[model samples]
Target: MQFENTLEFAQRLDKQDTLNSYRDHFLFPKVNEKQVIYFTGNSLGLQPKNAKKYVDEVMQDWEELAVEGHFYADKPWWDYHERLANPLSKIIGAKPSEITVMNTLTVNLHLLMVSFYRPKGKRYKIICEEKAFPSDQYMLQSQVRFHGYDPNDAIVEIKKRDGEHNFRIEDILDTITEVGEECALILIGGVNYYTGQVFDMKTITKAGHDIGAFVGWDLAHAAGNIKLELHDWDVDFASWCSYKYMNSGPGNASGCFIHERFHNQTEIPRFEGWWGTSRETRFLMKPQFEPMPNADAWQLSNAPILALAPYLASLELFDEVGMDALIKKRNLIVAYLEYILKEIDAQVESTFEIITPSNPKERGTQLSVFLHGEGKKLFEFLMKNGVITDWREPNVIRLAPAPFYCSFEDMFRFGQILKQGILEKNSELSS
Candidate 1:
């Protein structure tokens, strides 16, 4: 586990990496005809080489089969979503029957709230982390407004203590207790988008349940990045976008997981559509809506095959290697990245603080760096040098080395570029 900030050490690690072959599967961004080091998978994944092949198959089916493609094409449009269930289920730790691929992340969250966020008298407030992804904040505000309650009254945010970058687990549990019977739902990001902190979902779920509240997670940053056990954790419902760590391309189809207990609850409220009806009765076009016997019951429209093709392609890779292997490489790379950052800070006398948790169990592949004094200069320097990372407001750069395609050598090259950027800033200020 010893890490050295040297090209030889990084190259040696790359030589022994079992997942090194996966780098070739993706199309890395090129700058001036050279490949750029990409560290933005937590925002948008690189395109998989097989994604085109998968899209082509669907296009060919459309050209040849037309309307009949619904029945005759390979991986028929009628069941395209089903094709992803098994692999998707394994990735998120649920049964195929409990999982369904459909709309984007926020849309699914709204639909799920229709059923899981049923607010009875006094139990109408929702609890979540402060500074959740903007989409989540907007959704929560709108959902609360739709229910005829002011957001200030209906939304309880779990804020970090003064000057802390992440929320404390005890504080979260105590907040749940403080809310008590007023809490209708407890929803949070499985991984905080900005700080790269992974919340303790198992304990949080248990706390919510004990207080008679439904629990769910926005796994936009966690779903494929970290292994989850939604069913065993007794999570009532959850939704995630596949484009992040899943490497399913931008704006690809997302996934939903509903507890098996909700499958037979025909009385549950939902925004239903034809796609959610039973396959047997779908062709009948009957007036009565007979919802499917699984998570598909939440689907509001037909599958978007084109958008889903890339997801299937990526899931094939996940299925082949499994999460256990991916997570192992992810942890190793994260450690190496942390080591490199610390070494640069120690050697260069620069201010670079890692805001991401040091514990491997509390984070996935992301490391958020808080740069002081010459933050924007260093960021622009790295970008010009082709070291692509994500930047947030006020001076934090998020570098996420995706396990499927990023290599140990990438860490080495990134470290070198970062050091150069820091030195460049110093020279600029001195001049």
Candidate 2:
């Protein structure tokens, strides 16, 4: 599809968009008294207008029903988390019984490690990608240290080739094989946060299982942004934050996928809590902990109704539109964005290096661009001009044109803003 850098071209794409009307469902922030062109959905998603209604329902339940709201409310507070399972299952390609809403992402990872990361003798090392998200890095380091091993020895990082931004699948498989006997766990981010590169999870999971290692994924960025088949991929376990592309509120509840094969395995150690017990026996005050037959066995406490409310609201949108539709729009919009970037680069003769994979299969909503010749100042200019985006250290700016709320017009407008920012920076220097 040939893309032209013109307003009419962008508007035509918008008109043809089936999900274009859904953009009105979100609440955008105003900058300079106008709605900002949001590009940071990879970090925090725009709030759904219905999110307020969901939260209000929960609040009213608590207000009027009191403690009895646990069983009497419209959604029933006690089993409210269960409502998310079916829709979420569709999004991540897992059975409803295999998925659960639980603690935050890193916390869930730590809790899941209690069951999956069993290290003994030589098979004690954990294999992960180099430069993982800092939270993951800290979690791995702390977990290994807790198990009485130096992190430098216990964590095996698969490094990218020098001068390359993305890790090769061959290098990853080779690392897993080389660390074969020693690798106890293989956990990697399904979509790399920094480079916006989507790892080959199914192949990587197979490689990890070929050896004697439990494999898992941190799907923080991949959860709603990419197509995932956690169940069919035979992933041992996985966790993700709901705030980013999932469009839940900030720091909301997380989603977990534990393959059904592990459901009734009582021998697998987990940090049991009040909610982990069977629901029928929960009110009985039984001393014995009888775990649920599903993924709810991992729940340590009661669900956070406020957080889950927004998440359920967001999931309704996902269910209505479906992932297939989202991905279709995502591919075209991202391609259009890339074209606009290249066209702007040619027009301005500015060096803007997009480090993300050009292959649509290897990326999601994000584009991490290295802003050469224009750095912090250009980022500031965009911010002032109502182009809300993300900035990493040094010069790379991350722009995630989320398909739900972001339009093709946003892409064209961003290009114009980017070009203006660069030219303005040059003018200041020349003056």
Residue 6's C-alpha lDDT in candidate 2?
98
Off by over 4 Å in 1: none
Pairs with steric clashes in candidate 2 = none
- What is candidate 2's lDDT per residue for 1-431, written digit by digit as tens? 88999999999999999999999999999999989999999999999999999999999999999999999999999999999999999999999999999999999999999999999999999999999999999999999999999999999999999999999999999999999999999999999999899999999999999998999999999999999999999999999999999999889899999999999888898999978889989989898899999999999899999899999999999999999999999999999999999999998857889999999999999999998877798899999999999899888999999999999999999999989988877788789
lDDT of each: 0.92, 0.95
Q: What lDDT does model 1 reach?
A: 0.92
- Itemize residue pairs with steric clashes in candidate 1: none
What's the CA error at residue 70 for candidate 1, in Å? Answer: 0.6
TM-score each candidate: 0.99, 0.99
- Per-residue lDDT of model 1, residues 45-80, tens digit only: 999999999999999999999999999998889998
